[model samples]
Target: MKQGFVKVAAATPDIRVADVWHNCEEIRKLLSEAEKEGAKVIVFPELCLTGYTCQDLFTQDILLKEARRALERIAQQTKNSGSLVFVGMPLAVDGELYNVAAALNDGRILGFTTKTFLTNYGEFYEMRQFRQGPEKARVISYEGQEIWFGPQLLYQAEEMNELIVSAEICEDVWSPVPPSIQAAREGAVILVNCSASDETVGKDSYRQELIKGQSARLMAGYVYANAGDGESTTDLVFGGHNIIAENGTILKEARRFTNEMIISEIDISRMLGERRKNTTFQTAKERNLPRISFTVNLEETRLTRRFGANPFVPQNMEERAKRCEEILMIQAMGLKKRLLHTNSKTAVVGISGGLDSTLALLVTAKAFDMAGKKRKDIIAVTMPCFGTTDRTYHNACLMSEKLGATLREVPIADAVRTHFRDIGHDEDVHDVTYENAQARERTQVLMDIANQEMGMVIGTGDMSELALGWATYNGDHMSMYGVNASVPKTLVIHLVKYYADTCEDAELRAVLLDVLDTPVSPELLPPKDGEIAQKTEDLVGPYELHDFYLYYVLRFGFEPGKIYRLAKIAFEEQYDDETILKWLRTFYRRFFTQQFKRSCLPDGPKIGTVALSPRGDWRMPSDACAAVWMKDLENLTFNKTGGYSL
Candidate 1:
């Protein structure tokens, strides 16, 4: 599998109770189906070769013999499948019956991972028919084949080293210590569970959460295949709730009672990266378990997993509102502490009527409220320069007055012209110097005012701007404290909107809503017909795409190529491959080259997992070259079908 993505499936095929031949045929059909879909790893429910509802039939000698025969048949059926398959069955070892998951690949039985925990409480009578497996792994002869049979068998792909997998049958995962935990510690990136957990009143939700929690705890991919309909409903009904999760997120889940197959590509590289970053997740001190090597065709896995376009913001309305509230509180609390610690008399904010400044001002007001300081002491400065629009300026002044902050209107056009003349620069010639002069001039004004009033200049530059190095150095970049440093541009929009929707003051709400609608601009260049010119997105690419790139690049250390692939999937409908590739290249170039700006960032609260604060999460050499990353993007060639190939 390329990119460390292995397509895995959890299939729950309908089975007949105690009918080994019928169950074997169903398993073969589902195996073929999953293989046809290019699944490299597939899992089935526990004891599917002979249904879990067999009761006394599980102990019959004929049933056990037929199950072994069915196992051999399933193994033979995988000759041309080129997939590592795990199917459940019952086996008789040393005259003791044990339920186990047999690992099969390329026409042979690789190993058998027996269920370690037997369920005996409540409606489960697994202990009656099966005993616990061995504490330690051991090799055994089954029909002249020396197969590894234990709970600690790890099936590793010979092609992709990161595609190591392990299995635990039904009750083992429910136990305090799952075998998969040790399996993960011993270098298993993917864990599969062959489960026959029947449905109860609220068990499905609990089961889903359990599987998600286990994957999150171990930092591995988890695939669970449960028993479905067609099994005799002798008191317990099988729902066949198949699920595939990767690192706490469910990638694909089968509907209950459908007995369907759920498949998704698990990013093994991401999991490995997370594990490497997490220092507390220690591996086993000693490696004693057997490692079984399996082979699969090395091809690019067609990803079925969905990557959210906005990783910083939640998708659900309720969750997003809650997240916005929590983030706002975090911002306010951080500012509140800075204010109290410094005993500052005022919090100065440059209100531009843009999302970042508006959020900064809101946070300042909240911090003032939290610190029991007078709101009038918070100076909200609106610096009108060449690019200031009537709409934005109006909103800025109104919002400041409504929030009870002392509004100050400072017109800086003449000041910028004087500075240009001093530098022997033409006032008419529009260039970076022209734009940066206005920015630096505004910053100079804010800093001097803060110094005069014993206040702190709250930085309004967001995480997106810092990531792209979009802010002017020593201008908007330098502040005493930055409340929105970790907040991304895409998230800033939502946060402002959330405040507008929740605030009780009608004038402030209207101003916020209008500010949210205004185009994001620095207002450094001259305006055209009173409308704002120099739209940021037209020059720097869309913030949504940049934010996505930033999240994956910093959060997971994903390579540029992988990030491109995920971006294509996330924004497939909105952006084409060439556009995504263009923006992605720009993102990497700016991110690497702009480290100098982030190397000396001011103190800011880290709100999310991804941050660029130099004193905290990220530290890099300012001169580090992005050639390697750019080269990865260069390798991606657009094809006629509008897809890219590396």
Candidate 2:
């Protein structure tokens, strides 16, 4: 697979009770389908060769002999399959029967991992037919070959060393201490469970949570295969609830009672990255667990995993709302601490009726409320420069009044004109100087006003701006406390919208809605026919794309090429390959060159996992070069051959 994304499958094939030959054919069909889907690792339910409901038939010599022969047939089928398949069967070792998962690849058995925990409760009679697998590594003869047979066997991919796979039976995962726990501690990044779990009143939900939680705690990818239709439902019913999860997120889950195969790409690279970052996830002295190394054809895995266009923002509405509320509280609490610590009389925030400033003002008002101070003590300043439009200015004035904050209007056109005259610059020539001068003047007004009122200036720049270094240096960049510093621009709009939906006052809601509708800009360039000019997205590219790039690059440490691949998939309908590559190159260039602003960032609460706060989450050298990143982007060809020259 390409980019450390190993395609894996959790398959549940319909089984007939004690019909080993028929089950082998079913396994063969599923294996063909999975291999066609480009899955390198495919797992089947526990004891599927001889159905879990076989009851007393499991002890029959004829049935055991047929199961072994079926396993050999499946092993031979792997000669041309090119994918590793894990199938379940009963193995007799030293006159004791044990349920085990046999790993087969390349015309032979890679290894056999016996189930360490056998269920003996309620509907399960596994312990009656089998003994507990040994904890230590051992060898057994299978088809005249010495096979590693134990619960501590790990099948390591020789090509992809990070893709070490381990197996456990159904009850083993539900045990107090799963074998997968030690398996993960021994560097198994992917854990497969050959499960014969029967569906009960609410077992499916609990099973899903168990799989998700274990994968999260272990920081590993988990594949669960359950027995499905055609099994003897004498006392219990199997639902075949197959699930594929990676690091707490279930990528694909099959419907209960259905014979289905769920194939999804598990990001081994991301899992390993998370494990390395977590200091508590320690690796113990290797149990000297016998490892079976195998090789697979190396090719770029066509990723079937979906990447969200906005990773920073939650896709679900309820989740997004909850996240927004939590972020608001963090921002408010951070500001409240500053207000109480400094004993400031007022909180001054310059508002342009844009998303970031509006969010800052809202958080400031909340901080004042939390500190048991009057909202009027929060001063909302609206500075009208050369390019200020009627829409934004009107919204700003109305918002401050409705929120019961002291509104201050400072017109800066005259001051800017005087300064330009002093510098002997033409007023008609619009350039970076013209734009930055207005920003500096506005910041200067806010600072002086805060000093006059015995308060601190609350910054409105967001994380997206910090990443792209979009703020004017020493202008809008400096502040006493930045509430929205860790918030991204894409998420800032949602925060404002969340406030609108929750606030009971209709007028405040309407004004916030209008502010959300306004074009994002600095309002430094002159207006055209009284309309706002110099849109921020037009100059710096879309904030959404930049935010997407920022999230993957910072959170997952993804390279430019990988991010580009994910972006093309995530934004296929909205943006084409050319547009994605164009903005991606711009993102890399700006992000590296703009680290100075982030290196000296103001105090802000780290609201989410991905943050640019220098004191908290990110600490990067400002002088680091972007040459390597840029060169990778330049080399990307972006064609049908998976977008790279390699």
Q: Which stretches of candidate 2 lie over 4 Å from their true place?
A: 285-287, 638-646
lDDT of 2 by residue, 1-646 (tens): 7778999999998779998889999998998889888898899999999988888788899999999899989888888666788999988888989899999988889888988888887877787889999978688887799999988678888777878899888899999999998889988999999999988898999999999999999999999999999789888888999999999999999999888999999999998898888889998675677788876767788887798988888999999999999999999999999999998999999989888899999999988888999999999999998899998999999999999999999999899999999998799999888988899999999999999999999999999999999999988998999999989999999999999999999999999999888889988898999998879999889988999999999988988988988888889889878888889888898999999988988898889988988876888999999999998888787568544433
Instruction: Evaluate model 2: give its TM-score.
Output: 0.98
Q: How accurate is candidate 1 locally (lDDT)?
A: 0.92
User: Per-residue CA lDDT of candidate 1, range 413-510, in tens?
Assistant: 99999999999999888999999999999999999999999999999999999999999999999899999999999999999999999999988898
Q: Rate the local accuracy (lDDT) of all candidates.
A: 0.92, 0.90
The residue ranges of model 1 lying beyond 4 angstroms of the native Cα positions read none
Give the TM-score comparing model 1 with the true structure, all chains together.
0.99
Candidate 2 lDDT at 280 equals 92
